[model samples]
Target: MIKTIIFDFGDVFINLDKHATEKELLKLGLPSITEDLEYINESYETGKITTIDFINYYQKLLPDVSEKKIIDAWNSILKDFPKHRLKFIQKLSENKTYLLILLSNTNELHIDWIKENVPFYNNFKSCFNFFYLSHEINLRKPNHDIFRFVLDNHQLNPVETLFIDDTFVNTNTAQELGINIWNNDPKKEDITNLFTIKSNLF
Candidate 1:
């Protein structure tokens, strides 16, 4: 029997852009996805850098871009959160048959947006016993170490864990570690209105 339910934050619960941020960044003449920006983002999330310092770094790199504009663009990936999914999660949590957990690779900027916009964010957090993030854990998905960290730290039985994520490589890696996985391809797999377990939830 499945003992734990693990969910990915971006696509599993909240809607995320397929490539909107990179597209918007590209429009800003930053074609290479700036190592500086990525570093500052990851670093900030891990507590290696402060939010103000990260903002300053971005400002230093893109002198012409306003701080507000850059921040807005950075958070633009958070487009929507379907209410039906929330209802489903609520229903599942109400059942209380499994240990509910969340594992997501997210940065500070996105989190700030969630705090500001999602009124149910606190309730969602309360529904899970464990909520892990790449930045906080200093490990990211698609990396075996992170998956191992989650499983070992939680004392989870791989066979009894079902991990849901939007990224194929992430799901692929978890599957390799013996955890049942679901690759939630939005174009092919619509989880927004899910109620019952389907053959292809994976």
Candidate 2:
């Protein structure tokens, strides 16, 4: 039986253009998505660097790109948070059937943008029994340690926990830790259909 539910914030809840950031960066004169750039992004997501340092790195690399422009480009990947999804989560929270947890691999800037843009951000956050953000926790998904931390922190049994994420890499890691997983495809899968789609697990 599933006693706890862990959800990913990105595609699973809010829609993301995943490629929008890269496209916007290209427009802002980023030559290509290099390994070094990926490293810097991951470092920022892991809270190894400050927001100023992140923007400074971009400024130094793309000298012509303004700080505001770089920030915009970086945040372009974020899109809308549909009301239906919020309602779904809200209903789930009201029922109080399972221990609801939100686990997201996100940086500070993106979160700040969400808080500013998403009108019901605080209400959505309150739906979760516990909310864990990567930068705030110094941990990101696809890392075994993060999965362990969540489980250990809640004293949750892996066999009775279900982790839903849009990323296969993250779900794969959670599965290895013996948790149930739904490696959802955002293009075709809507998280509101959780029970219908994965009924056998329940």
Candidate 3:
């Protein structure tokens, strides 16, 4: 039986324009995403670099873009958190039917934006038994080690844990580690229908 649920934040909870950042950067005269840019992003996501360094790296690349512009473009991906989803999770938390954990590959800048914009961020956070932010935890997903860290730290059995993520890559890694998964398509699926949609698994 699935006794625990691990949820990814972006697209799964807060909506995201997956292509917004790339498009914004391109508009800012970023030629294309380079290997170095990807490395810098991954490093920032994993808390290997500071927010100041992250912004500076981009500023150095797009010399004409101001720090505020760089930050705005980077955060353009984040969208609104729907009220129904918050209610669903809050109800789920109240019932205590399963151990609810939130695991997100997020950085400081995005989080700061959410704190300022999402009025219920704190309420949403309070629903989770454990909240794991990649930058805070020094780990990011699609990496097997991060999944293992969650399991080990929570003393959770992989077989009894269900991982839900909008990204197939992330769910795939957890599946290989023996966790049940739902590779949710944000366009077609809403997490509020979790039990109805993944009824067989539950």
Task: Name the best candidate (by lDDT).
Answer: 2
Please tell me which model should have the higher TM-score, number 1 or number 3.
3
In the range 1-202, model 3's lDDT, one tens digit per residue, is 8999999999999999989999999999999999989999999999999999999999989999899999999999999999999999999999999999999999999999999999999999999999999999999999999999999999999989999999989999999999999999999999999999999977
What TM-score would every model get versus the actual structure?
0.88, 0.98, 0.98
Off by over 4 Å in 3: none
Error of 3 at 100 (Å): 0.6
lDDT of 2 at 87: 99
Residues 1-202, model 2: lDDT tens digits: 9999999999998999999999999998888999999999999999999999999999988999789999999999999999999999999999999999999999999999999999999999999999999999999989999999999999999999999999989999999999999999999999999999999998
Native-to-model Cα distance after best TM-score fit, residue 151 in candidate 3, in Å? 0.5
lDDT, residue 177, model 1: 95
In model 1, how large is the Cα lDDT of residue 101?
Answer: 88
Worst 10 residues of 1 by lDDT: 193-202
Candidate 2 Cα misplacement greater than 4 A, ranges: none
Checking candidate 2 for backbone clashes, the offending pairs are: none
Error of 1 at 129 (Å): 1.7
